[model samples]
Target: MNFSYSFPALRGIQAGREFYTVMCPLRLIPKIFLFDEEEIPAEHRAQRVMNRSRIPDITNYILENPKDYIFSSLTASVDGEMIFQEHSEELKDIGYLTISLDSKFLINDGQHRRAAIEEALKVFPELGEETISVVFFHDLGLVRSQQMFSDLNRHAVNTTSSIGILYDHRDQLSLITKALISDIPLLNRYTDREKVNLSKNSPKLFALNHIFNTNCRLLGKRKGEIISEQEKEFANQFWVLLCNTITEWQEVLNKKTSPRDLRVNSIVAHGVFLEAIGIIGYYLYFYHPDEWEKYVKKLKHIDWQRDNKEDWQGRAYSHTGRINKNNETVQLTANLIKKKIGLPLTEHEQKIEDKLKEASPLGT
Candidate 1:
């Protein structure tokens, strides 16, 4: 097989394992990759069967946004040893990698991304120059190649939600979440910036993920919705007023209560309640604009004490002892606040409330 292809590559080593990094143009990727599912013996194929369903969303993501997206480095097994040719003394650090595949190339990672890239090309073929990083491993036949696949995934841990929020610039909600944490001192001062869950002794008040989701709800936003400047300002003013009005939030900020104590003692410190407040805030701001501040006062009356299990049990927590964080709980919490403030539920909310009248929703 005349399988020659060449590209400039950077040489790197990890724990004495050698790998070559190459920037392959988008149009060339599909041509170079050969999914193992099609030709190889079942025992020899290191990759899972390609899930065609996942490709379209990723393909649309590339086509729709066109820019500001990420695809992690694709890991593939070369069909044969690739040769590195030194080009110049001045560029000793980089060299051209040339490969001739004697057999079908195998992907140990990023198979879905590879499939999506190919699909995306059908519509956005002009993105031919766009590049994705790839790391090549020398072929090790069937058994060793399978082992490599196992090893690659075994060490891969999903990125934490907070870290994703902190690093993502593409998602509009991530940007708003960052702004909220920066603009609201209370959230910034007490938030666990790296994790989604707070440990018992952690001084941080909430997860960055939690706040992002809560604020999105408050803005009446579905995920990925872009907010107008008016909505942004509304968010800024509403959250500041919320912190000022929620008694436990004020006590935590004032040092009258420690973050750990607040976390342990009150439902208010949980992200679930924050999201519930977001639902209420959206209703008040969207429908009762004139009475939002007045409604904020009603939040202070909630008996947030953790010992007040009677207060949240059937309303926010399930019988098996779990905080219900779904839409049902959100409506329930909104209804609770609506009752306290003497406001009526919207027709949609009243319906949800009626169905959930007897129990709290559960399951993570």
Candidate 2:
């Protein structure tokens, strides 16, 4: 076999059933091995975690039929003395599944498999399995080994983050486009810098994606096509309007005596932004463009209860906060749209505004 690894260790230790040890300067090495399929040993096979069964029927399987699992010679090696000191000492007499190997001591593909085998052997003292079968890489380093581990485990039968999941399956243009479009509302509420943060790490992005993709169990429709043309158009317009709205919101947000009242951290804007998109696109689509623009600009410039970061936090958790004089001005704009376009508002929202108007005459 043409091995990419150099095993000078072979000269130091006899390559037989006994373990070998050698020493060399640190570098990189890669190698490959072929494994044979055979009947799993009774003791080893019983050790497999197949469902909830606690005891592996190892002795029975080994006694009844031992010819099914085949064992192969390990074609692994490491920098002789260094590996003996740093890595292989753990393997002293401990038998393991030698599946394959790659650069810098990369375990080819059997981490879980090896783990299960070890777990089984640990519980069963009769197996006498000491050394695990592992291939060796002469060339790869620690960083590359970590990256390889990530690649293998990412797809190895495990649950992962939605963003991580999204990134992996994002080769589909439709999915990527949907993710970008759906995250706008969240990106808007936080400052522009906040948007970047959301794009990279925020759950808001995932939440919006869930809502947009209708991935929600209660609200989403899974049977329909990925994204309908009407939905696409709605998404496009919604993004455009939200971007403008956020820009306007910031202009007002900065002018407040204390912008903390606005509760920028809350998801209120997500709901409001969603509602506004529906209202503007579906109901008030034909409104006078310039007049609408002027009103929006004016709304953006208005100072209100939303000026407080605490208020923004309250809004995040569904608290509308007190409608002081400053907030009433901003509330009026929202109320006017609700009345003029006949946009839908939940009873709770109407009550919130009513209370605000009562508390803050200036806003009314």
Candidate 3:
């Protein structure tokens, strides 16, 4: 490889700063070894590696301006000796990319660069033809690699967007949302406001958003602290309950003798309805999703307390709330509550029982 002769050390250069000395003007002349993909195992390669649809701008920037790149000076040593070898004919013919067998610190720290190179090389086969200079440290341990990866990616601007998170898990989230919306007839003619509202107002969405955000936060606290099996189970339970509750509420609204008021409704009334349905829905979605579907249908047959004009008097207010569970609206009828959210509840009982049969044995 025709390595650049003048290797310069770039420190934090200020506007008025004069030119300074290079860290290794004592150059370890560049050379090449036979390209060995097996030198670094594939599993140890990188994390979250995937086929990116587009080349990130930063990768292009690095490729175009390789000299601007800086490396940790000590990364050149391998087993207490420098491993900077001379360039072979094959390495010289294509000197565009470099490997860092010397510094696990650099590899861990430069994951974005490494990931970008890996992805970019896939589409641009010519990248494989190029052999760029890499520094490898032979003795860097796992703990050090972990620390390096953490430090490298932990820049000040490390925030991911809500849409980014959504897109990241789109496959799972989309499937679930599609299934729920499909099953709920009321949501068939769904509006964006209603969808956003559903995402915001529905108990299932609320619990789901909480679970997702909490899990993300936990992982953010430490590199490997992802959601545990038990927490995942709880979240699944929460999802089931929330979806069922929304469906049931829709059914109840369909039976109203008066106008519906999801917004102007009392927080206590909404919470009672939401919590009660969520508990029941969670069980049913798993144990008897189909039976639960039938049970939801039967809700339209009964008259709930809110369906009566006398019971709903002075029930609503200007603002719906998050707390204040004491505000009285109206007691859901014993018969309807029993039929909808409560028991003898063969239909409801059957829903969960049937679901249990279909459910997998839970755990890690």
- Output the number of the lDDT-best candidate: 1
The window of 10 residues in a row where model 3 has the poorest summed lDDT is 26-35
Model 2 Cα lDDT, one tens digit per residue, 1-364: 1324333333122334244332221111111222211255533221222332422333333333333432222333232222332225664433332212332232434433333333444454334333333444442344444454456456755333334334443223335344554465443344222121233233232233333332211112232235455455544544455456654344434553222333343233333433333334432334433344443334343233344443332222233543222233333334544544445555655786677657654665
lDDT of 1: 0.80
Give the clash count for each candidate. 2, 47, 24
Residue 131 lDDT in model 2? Answer: 33
lDDT (tens digit, per residue) of candidate 1 on 1-364: 2567788898778667667899999898898888775566677678878888998888878887887677889998886757877768887648988887554577889999998998888888888899999998887688878888889889889999899889888777788888888888898898877899888788888899889889878887865667888888878888888878888887888899888888777788877788888888887888888778888887787787756765576566766656677777766776776777788888987777677653444421
Find the 10 residues in a row with the least total lDDT in model 2. Answer: 24-33
Candidate 1: residue pairs that collide? 190-205, 265-306
Instruction: Assess each prediction's global lDDT (C-alpha) against the native.
Output: 0.80, 0.36, 0.36
TM-score of each predicted structure versus truth: 0.84, 0.30, 0.30
Model 2 C-alpha RMSD to native = 16.4
